[model samples]
Target: MRLRVQGLPTAAGVTRVLSLLAVVAAVGLLPWLSGRDPALTVLRARSAEQEPTKEALDAVRSDLGLDAGPLDLLGSWAADLLHGDLGTSWVSGTDVLPSVVSGLQVSLALMGAAFALALLLAAALVAPVLVRGRRSAGAFAAMLAAVPEFLLATVALLVCGVWLGWLPTSGWQGPAYMVLPALALGVPAGGLLGRLVADALPAVLDERWVELWRGAGVSRARISAAALKRVLPQLVPQFGMAAVGLTGGAVAVETVFAVPGIGRTALGAAKSQDLPLLQGAVLALLLLGLVMGAVAAFTRRRLLGPALRDASLALPAARPVRTHPAIPLTLLTVLAVAIGWGLLRDPYTVNTAARLAAPSFSHPLGTDGLGRDVIARLGHGAAPTVGTAAAVCALSLLVALILGFLPGVAAGAADIANALPPVIVGILVAAAAGPGTGGAALAVALISWPPLAAHAAALVQEVRASAFLTAQRAIGASPSWILTRHVLPSVAAPVARHALLRLPGIALALASLGFLGLGAQPPAPEWGLLLDESRAYVERAPWAALAPAVALALLAGLAVSGAAYAQGRRVPRTGGAGSTGSTGKKKEALVEV
Candidate 1:
């Protein structure tokens, strides 16, 4: 019997087209939904010093054709798009195409460099697992993955640019300026993609054919290549995800390094409320995302061809390893203690006389430029940052569980949704609802579901193909019984665990949104807001920034170590040191979710 591919090419194609239309409609509706006067915004953007007056605003509105309704404007933009026109920038009055194209060139170059770095890092992590059968590298990779792009970029800027002066800190001047940003964007993405690759390696290696190749004396290089091929089809989606990640991550990285990329341009456009330019930037990113998703889907189809139905013939079971959770637990304890200790002080209390003070017995983490206790802010900030992250994770899990069962819908939707990263989503949400912690949380939740959904869909497919389920079906077990007894239990646990691991990254994304001024406003004690507030004063009172920064890093590290312990692999104890005989049992955990 043939297994029908989920949402065959035609259905997926239609889904993508609809997704594009939906995004266009949303962009067109922004002005109306936001309830902001486009004419006044344009006037201010063009001449910030100019005061808004009825006559001037009306003249500007008449000149720009803002008198038309949103639908009418959308129709005009669509018509122009068909004619290879992308409309004009509201701020600069230049054709949007040229500016967008220029930004894309720089962004693509940065993304390419970042992709290369990611590949290198992935290879570094995967090579040891494939060649030496060592799984310890996974824990390190997890740590690498947990570091947020913004934090990493800031560190790179400080060390490479300021302290060592080894590379340019900010600009798109030359390749020298690209290094830090590329590393910032690539490292976490590499760690993420690499761990996934490592997770898939076990099942591929456990195949009987792998043993046959070894028995036949196939060279190690040849065998490794074959193993990779077996896993590549499954990994294509992840590769697409990594591509989206790099694209979205470029926003923060570019801002830090001051690269003239589309992301930065879009961010600037949003801040200045340049509707046309903002629309163009989002459109370009959407197209890039769809194109990348298409490429991944096409590649997966080609790799599988028509011969590979029921791909999960044998779902490899991973024996859990003994892991001590003490370290992760300890790290978390320290953070909790710090926050608890900080709660005793008034975060709002300002001591102007002690502004930017260094750490002292009176002030544990010193004072901010505004003279607010860093410890109190750090303590108070935990609720918004961590709580929202937790909420986002929970909502994402629910959506993932629901969408996971609908494989076709999930696959197509993942492609569309993955394009809009948290920052991009925040841009849209901020435009619509106004920037605040609530909107930022909503934005994070919107983009956070796709990964979990994809994971659920894959697991659903695998569990449905399992022999036990097939046997039950043959024996006349009802569909609901099989689903409830076998499917949900199998899919839910792994997906929830995956969501648990993602908690820190989610928090980081929220912080990033805040840092970009799309989240909690100043004086709210949001971690990202605090980072933003202290950045200018970083050179003077490094302690103010360092407090929150250290808290974030510790949070990430705790997640990594905790995940490592939770999913620890069982290593063979009795195998001879040089022996490859135990290689077949050396599979990484099956769930890299």
Candidate 2:
């Protein structure tokens, strides 16, 4: 049981044991986690492409040695890991590592192309923040931020690949096929980078050296470089996060773009319950993320060196002035009201004669294949989209507060919750409740709360450790009273901020679920479902897809923008509400594709 540095000790053994336990949870528990009998389910899986008779299932189980003990299975997997074998996929019956490598290469290439474009775009956008001001930069970021990668993918496919016949619409054809997917990924990450750089630039620009440089008639480009030098160290964490977020978000993007990547592979593995493939993909992604994070951390320290000793040398806020979410919140409200007005003003009145009409009079966004008013369906979708998001955020916040204060519950819940991704949770809900709007809301909340609770739990732990809480404890305050007055109030701002940040993610998860046929079914006008419906007519009626894609992306952007505005205003010198990059951390949804 001993572990580490060269044959370690008791404490290390405990840690190793815990690590083994996690491995057990991840691999040993997979069969039950799939909500099926492993032998039977694997035999009948979509990937299997055929149903197995009982005798066949038994024979296959015997061949695969599913009768082995959990520990034996673990040992087998350990042996496989030692040999770098991820096991063969049940579907293809080929070596999984090779496919995984191919997928990784695609994902990395896609993300690599994205990273380069992001840097250039970020530089261009941050330029204005240096020479001009944030107004133009902020406005532009908001505009681009409004679009999610999947919607971006659909649009690019509709316009460039399909309508114009300029690019291939499907497959990993070549570098030519990569452009739309890379651009889809790049634009949002670039917007994030620009926002981060802009946030870091203000104080650097305000400094006296900059004034001297300006007075001495230095080129704005050179001056901007100086500002960038000061900003670069602070950007490391955001950059790392952007990369991580992009990787995490790649599942939907890769699937939509028909790109063979780990994200898409993982989703397929999950659906088929391909335990080894799924585990390998998750482990690889987790390791990749860890490496990226380590690099970011090391680079941050190296670049920050002596500057780290000075808080004054850290990145500056977008505006030191108090920021209210009033404008963004107002915008959200106006959108809701407008959508409601549309719903009342004949958005849903269907006309067969107008079916598949292009954008023109009487139907602004044009008619879908169904002849349903495109604008009406989009407008109708807004209610469920916004309402479901609001409800889920509210529920998640409430759950986070309750579980976060209870140490036992928070610790146990976080472990279980983090293990299950939104898609898996949505599928379970879809199975239990059947596909519909109510189940969709529940699915969103079901997938949404775990991470939020984990955040709240950490915050609560920090608060409980503080001197003020200890002092209150010494005064003989009841745990409940202390939790309510101290813990609740202390955690509220962060919980609120976290909720705001998670909303768009939740929205996207809902959309992804709906895309997979687990949410509101077709003809329901749910934005995500609308995308599903529009896929068939995308070539002939591109606007069918275009309308929902635009609306949904904008909704995500506005939600995120609201969170960003709150973070800008609320993050203070005390650093109480987590990193300034809090919103950016969860902005994974937009770029995740």
Give the candidate number with the greatest lDDT: 1
lDDT by residue for model 2 (458-515), tens: 6666676666666778889899898667677767766676787677767777776776
Q: Report the C-alpha lDDT of model 1 over 1-593, residue by residue, as the tens digit.
A: 96768866665567766776787788866766665788888898689998899999988878877778777777877788889887888888899999999999999999999989998999999999789877666667767888888888877777677778899888888878889999999999899878777766766787899899999999989988988877778778778878888878898889878899999998898887887888888888877877787788788878777787435434355434335788888998999999998999899998899999999999989999879999999999999999999999999999999998887766666667887788988988888778899999999997788778877777777667666777888999999898888888777876887898888889999999998888999889999889878878766787887788889999988877776677664355332211212322332244454
Error of 1 at 23 (Å): 1.4
Could you say which candidate leads in TM-score?
1
User: TM per model?
Assistant: 0.87, 0.75
Off by over 4 Å in 1: 1-14, 47-51, 302-322, 454-498, 568-591
Residue 296 in model 2: lDDT: 77
Query: Residue 338 lDDT in model 2?
Result: 46
What value of lDDT does candidate 1 attain over all alpha carbons?
0.81
Per-candidate clashes come to 0, 5
